[model samples]
Target: MWYRISSSTVIWVANREIPINSTSGVLKLTTSGTLNIFRNTSDLTPIWSSNASFSVQNPVAELRENGNFVIREENDDNPVSFFWQSFDHPTDTLFSGMKLGKNFVTGQEWYLSCWKNSDDPAQGEYTYRLDPTGYPHNVIMKGQNLTFQTGAWNGVRFSGRPKSSGNTMYTHKVVINKEEVYYMFEQINSSVSRLMINQSGKGQRWTWLQQAQKWSILYEVPSDNCDNYNICGAYGDCNINNGPVCGCLEKFVPIDVDAWTKGDWGSGCTRKKPLDCQKGDGFRKYSHIKEPDTLSTWIDERINLKECKKSCLRNCSCMAYASLNISKGETGCLQWFGDLKDIREVSEGGADLFIRVAFSDSDREKNKATFIISLSVVGGVCLLGLPLAFCIWKIIKKKSKLKRSKGILQGSPKGILRGSSKEHSNMSQKEDPDLPYFSLTTLLHATNNFANSNKIGQGGFGPVFKGILEDGQQVAVKCLSETSTQGTNEFMNEVKFIAKLQHRNLVRLLGYCTDEENKMLIYEYMPNKSLDWHIFNEFRNKLLDWPKRFHIIDGIARGLLYLHQDSRLRIVHRDLKASNILLDVKMDAKISDFGTARSFRENETTASTNQLAGTFGYMPPEYALDGILSVKSDVFSFGVLALETVCGKRNREFIHSDHLQHLSGHAWRLHREGRTLELVHQNISQESDYALEMIRTIHIALLCVQQSREERPDMATVVLMLGSNGELPMPSQPGFFTEGNIVGSDADDNTLLEGR
Candidate 1:
């Protein structure tokens, strides 16, 4: 076994199966182009051999970076030269870049066999491999008895494991040629990944986190009940979200609805009416469905979906048909004959399947489709009219808004104002020397001229769109909206401030775009969008479990602490809310939208001004009413954001069952009543272990949003309280707990878009 510094754990084991009681084993390459593993015993017999008979001039054996031990010619005469390689005979671990399939000509099969036990090197009963007996699909077996199967690849990804398609850490590829068929994944960056089949028969992907100095689970197989083969029986779609987890396809009925309702779903569905092979017999297309089992299916590589459908129609035995790969155009055909077994309906996996149905059912479906098309025509007309009317109204609004914007520009701007647009652009380049300058042409092409399809959301300053650079790097482009009240000052404030700051929890400013007509900033794109994107929605909130929510709270606290003390200069994020918190692929929260942020010197603890800015619900009483600003103002906002994350509801949008108090007041009441856990997001509070952690979070939130600035803890103290298990001070009444008492409660927060 070989070890490395990043991790002391065993990375590679040479002589896995053969054990020597005394002298152990020695792995060496022979004089010939062959590698062997031999146990150092009195008998002196080689236990494992590369078995390479091919001869090469000046042959040498070496191990490559990808953990491939190969014996090949020394020179570059033959680049593809490989007499033998250890990758051909993998033990249990499947490292990234290693192929997991078979070579037809060589008759060599590549698969991952589970280790017998933690201490044993023998292969176990479970085997995870690509089965090419039929249409290719990754499968798991318990000594030849199939347990789980990832539905065959449909061009983009496996029908069952759709998430394998768009993983950020790695990209998976499959190749089928005249000689070989294999599946391999390559890491996008220099990240170490390992796929191991455990002794229990489960396969999991682990990715090394350089910062955390540990590995995280990227994915796993057989994750749920639906993953089990034939769980829902034949001709039934399994949906884990469903209570029964199984349901009959359209135009079909349960074999025994009584048994099905009683949780005995072994007997799957049957057609209500048999297909008569009549001229009107047609297929019903089901979208977002996991294609049926492919063990007994027929596939044609040359034909398209249309050709496949024709073929299925001609063969009366064909039960269902679907396109093999819909990643691009419809290419290849897969037809399932007889009964469709192990079918599934997933939220976001697989392609559409067209199943055969009786003529009567087809006619009814046609009639329904006709009615829907007619209704859609009416709806389409209304939609077109609404957009036209909205555009006209928007034009008028834009003109009036333009007049107001010009009116503000007529006078010289005061404090916290940039000298001018020209100075704002020049000074940022001078001050933020490390910041990249993206040309307008480059940005325009990257964002498709700010196409609506690419637009992710709107901020106070402009529209934020997701863009891809020429290098395939995805970024969020924040272009200044023509009607935006935020101009030179706020723009420069963010560019200069965030450009100087560096932290994982702080949104990184990749670059900026400046021109006569455009003022734009480029940032690392957040795939999961803002915190408000999830918490404000009932269904999406489920994605944020208590652990994830707590993680975000902790991250936000650390980010705030960095801004207050750790950074080169003390910074205050004036606009901190759910909408301002962006989540990365790992669900790590990053504080974004720093256009309204302020900076304080080392000795400055507080600052006061007549200019009051920030969202209503998040602003503290002192900051909103008295125009006093400090680290506490940001702390108050953090408190509100934390409450929103835990409650799974917006601060201002909170609707109480008992009374009409805001979210903060609701939390205070719950705390006083010894029911602080009740205020937690319903989706997360189900776990008893995390109940205490959640209650403590709510307590910290209350302490941060205290009515008086003096009572609120500093960002450092808040971070300590969140990290340690130490007792916290009792929280007083939080500001803005009541709607009427909130300053600018009814006014638009967009007014704060412009700094004083």
Candidate 2:
């Protein structure tokens, strides 16, 4: 039996089906180099054996640190090439270094079979393994039934599993070659992880948590209704966020509409117009979607997308085509023939797929619009025979009416508001087409006329109130206070910048209200409140163990990365502190407060302003002193936030009896003395298993808070560093390191500045 030493939990059993039924069982190696387990010393028949192919001079049975029981020659210096390893036949739990694929050359496959139950070590009905049929992908099986699939490997990550990429805890990848094909993950740090399939046929990734002293579920497969393999059938797109969870692609209609309405989407969909491939069908592009299954696909790594399109057009049977590797500048082609299946909409990191369609269906909408406009113009000219001067005057009058309706302000035509006049009422909606508008009466009813009891939190821009709309949707209403330090410019700036952004980690903007003197912004309600509410409170801080703290740190880093590089606009969040980070029901972090944020053009890297606006301790030295701002400014703020999170104290208000220095300076001092684990909060310091991870986080924070901004890593590199175990460089002393003296020069409010 192979068991965990700490818990004595048996993960694998060699003789699960046949019990030895004796307490005097002995395991011994024979001269033939076979490892055998006998019922007793007097018994000659062996019950189990390593069964080595041939005899060896001296065979040694050893268990490796990564939980691999191996047999090797005694004097052999090679560590990897063992004669036999228990990893080759994993029973249930797959450790970090184990492979879950097959070797075609040796005809040996590695896979996982779950235990029969919690008490039984026998193999269960479920199996999880890599399938190499068409394009390699992970699949889950229950007996003979295909329960779920992880989609195909799309270079960066699995097509169906977008969250698997850029993970902070571990790095996962799939390797394909003539000799072998396998999927494996390696730990980024000292954390222990196991990927296992339970008896219920559910695949889950569990990480050992030191503070909790138990295994915490990092992720699970079949996580949603959409994860069911072929849930939507052929040519159907599954979007979990949608009402029905299944919908047909554009220009396609359900084959059985009544069945679909009844929630039986198994019949899938069919094209409205029949495809005439011989007549040269064109392809319609679909973005932000999981590419179709690659079962009947052809891949060419040498061709570009343009050439891939040409090649697909030449083949009558080709149904869809996409870039083989999304990360490598579209250098390869992945074309699917026949009907598309198992396609879903992924909110983030989804690939673009182009499906072949009839030429009439391809440009049907565009051609119809053009034909309607042309017919209208001809009909007007023939029917009325109007004079040129009269026609021009009518067009000018219509243009004037549109301009007035747009409510362009006197000085700011881009719709930046001054006062709450009727003209400025519809300005936000007109400027940001994606942003919805909320009526003043609706907000009044939601917040019960801004009652004091309804207020949740207060900020520089305004006070936040918890509200429930008429539709029973919970919302956070950020009502601008009469004595607010931030002006209308900052309010409009937040609307303009955050309206176009969509990210899981960023707070979502639901709608805005601009009713006379009352201005407010509505957001999805965050139940757990902000990070400061939990991390700073004496009683609440205990809920944030080491694992939860690390999770928050990773979430904040990813959110900042999205703002810096992944979003459509390059944004610099000047105010990123503990209070600005909100927690959801699951304790996932969502960044808020975009009032002091600034955006840059594609090629623009840095900007300077006479106004320095942000919290005092969170701002970098250059940004606070010289009014210089960039993405690095946010990185510096994140560093401070990370430190405060780890230590469970505010940087600006930190009071240590041993030193008068701020939190950054104190952390640096402890790090220099090789006592970095001391920086962990006392509430969570007893988690000795996470000491190394906490030290690494502190080291990363120090690197971000270094004196020179040039030395700071970009968000992408920072994310990589956080998720990797490679050696990091030595960090210098943090900026603004002072003893008992805090710098507050040429400033307005120390807490926040209406920088916009």
Candidate 3:
């Protein structure tokens, strides 16, 4: 909001947090020639000043075209020879070529601090800059906490930022040549472009598009959950494509299984076998990874990879070492002395890091070879029994046939799945015959070996691809990564629960497969994909008319009812939310993603757990806050989903001008004002039919999301309320939707908030 004659808006304020309330406000040069902002009401009150304690003999100030306001000696007309400049200290916005780090000689720190909120210019929690210590990784900090981290300088760009390397739009660098350490970006095109650190701490680079009369987002950092700092603690690695997300490096185990099982990885992993420290100690190479936190790291440019490893091995205290520069084929040395933290495996763009461990952990291979030879000699004599081999083949054929009988086949990926135990067959666990399986070859051909074109999207679980089988049937394939922390537990949950479920409203689980290393699930594809895609997308929302939206709401209710009461297993779909609701070609809704589903006996309906995992916004107050779950928990999520559908907005990401918490808060406000219809999506309004049904549906949604779990309506009653012309009960305020005391905008803005 900076300006022209038509509007005198200050786009960038020098002292934004301080307001000059009276017309008596004045900007003047003092007797000593230092400039300051002052008001008549309080002569001594200085809102802002040049900080020139000993003023120059002749001082002058000027605003450069690049938006730098500088004060310097009048005799020195050169712009670069300035005493002070506004660009040196930033507030929320960063322009091209701004130094954002340290002037070591002067002990000065320059960084970007976010405004309090979107409109308030007061300082907020987020700060972005080069943290000069431990080799200067660009970081985004929320107060004292590290929210995000970029690549450590790898002699090129930040080593972890693939996007920053080889970019034509701008040249980026981290300069640390003794006098200072700083990070700065020089744009190829500087006009009308600014990189803003939004109030939410998102680093967004916007370039104006004259033709579209809009700002285009070039890219942003903390792009996904993996960018979160120390998401996986010491000796653990984070892969966003994994369930439970955090996992230990090979041979390490969770320090606390109870906490990790409940989705807490803070007490990460410890060595299965501790290092013997130079006594039969060896370095295990970890490829394709972002290095751990460098708080206690040492770096030297003069050494090569060979010298680096030797130096680390020479020191008993050194825990790990890596090449300093990723660009130059593993050159230079970077060493960590103590605990390793904040490590993650990258899908692409990462360096190789080697961790030292004891040789005892590798001794199993030598012992296993001896065991194999002894077994081979014994099996030679057993081969004389031919009739037994035929019997074994017959039993396997029978099992294979039974697997195909249900229109789903089960098998392991060829040469991919290893029993993690033996040579005859690699079976990690006892094979379950309840669900059918799909062979890896079949799925590979169906999805082009999981090609990018076929990829629909990725979630915490892994990458999902849309595939076409030989029978002309389209299916969605979930390729479970071997490194995924979900392990076998979540996979079995989806298999056990979705297999026996028979309902039009529920997603059909065609089958599942486990190759030597690959784990996959085949589900019937939905042409319309997930509910969130259509409802939250502004352009797509127009396509979903009021009738279609109402239909979806009804379908979701029926699906939830089936889960709560009609299903063979009295199951609770614990992770229900918009993204979990898949839509078929005709826009019919189906409840999906049964990975978190839990079944209870009819007599036993409620359960509790210490840790929680689910999208945040749709989680019930009782379930989320206290871990009590039941059919009512699903009902609470349904309430949020239904409300979002009607409003064509997301509960978690909703923004309000009035400072309301989210969509639910705004809806509650509208309900009290007798203007609930105003909460409906603008696109849905053109078709005025079903206006009354729309209003009634919003009321029912409110009843479903009431703060008290006992007051909320069950899914069965919700269906009756929607289908029949019945009066809805008065609803209380929804959970997490107050005007004050909210953590984030969306309920399930889907952070690793489960740990909280």
Displacement of residue 596 (Cα, Å) in model 1 is 18
Q: Number of clashing residue pairs in every model?
A: 0, 0, 19
C-alpha local distance difference test of each model: 0.77, 0.79, 0.74
Q: For candidate 2, what is the TM-score?
A: 0.55
TM-score of each: 0.55, 0.55, 0.54
* Runs in model 3 lying further than 4 Å from the true structure: 1-12, 22-24, 30-33, 40-45, 53-58, 75-77, 159-167, 190-192, 218-223, 360-756
**Distance from true location, Cα of 420 in model 2, Å:** 7.3
The prediction achieving the highest TM-score against the true structure is 2
Q: Could you give candidate 1's per-residue lDDT for residues 8-69 as a string of tens digits?
A: 44445556676554566776777777767776644457887777777766778887777777
Tens-digit lDDT track of model 3 for 1-756: 242321422346666778566588878767676767886646877788867756677777777777677787889967598777777767777777688899979888888888786456778889888888787888889999888877567766654554232446666677887899888777686345667776667776666545534444555666545667887778888864454568898878899989988878888899998878747566778866787877788999989998998888889888888888866777889998888888877544567787877765543444667899989966964885767767877999998666443323453222222112122113423455656667767887898766766777665566678888897577899765544435466776787788889897999999887654456778988756788877776655765666568778988998888888887889888788888889864467899888778898989878987767677787887877778988889998888898999988888778887786778878888998899889888877654546788889999988988888899988889877886777677898888877444454343223334533
lDDT of 1 at 17: 70
True lDDT of residue 399, candidate 2: 80
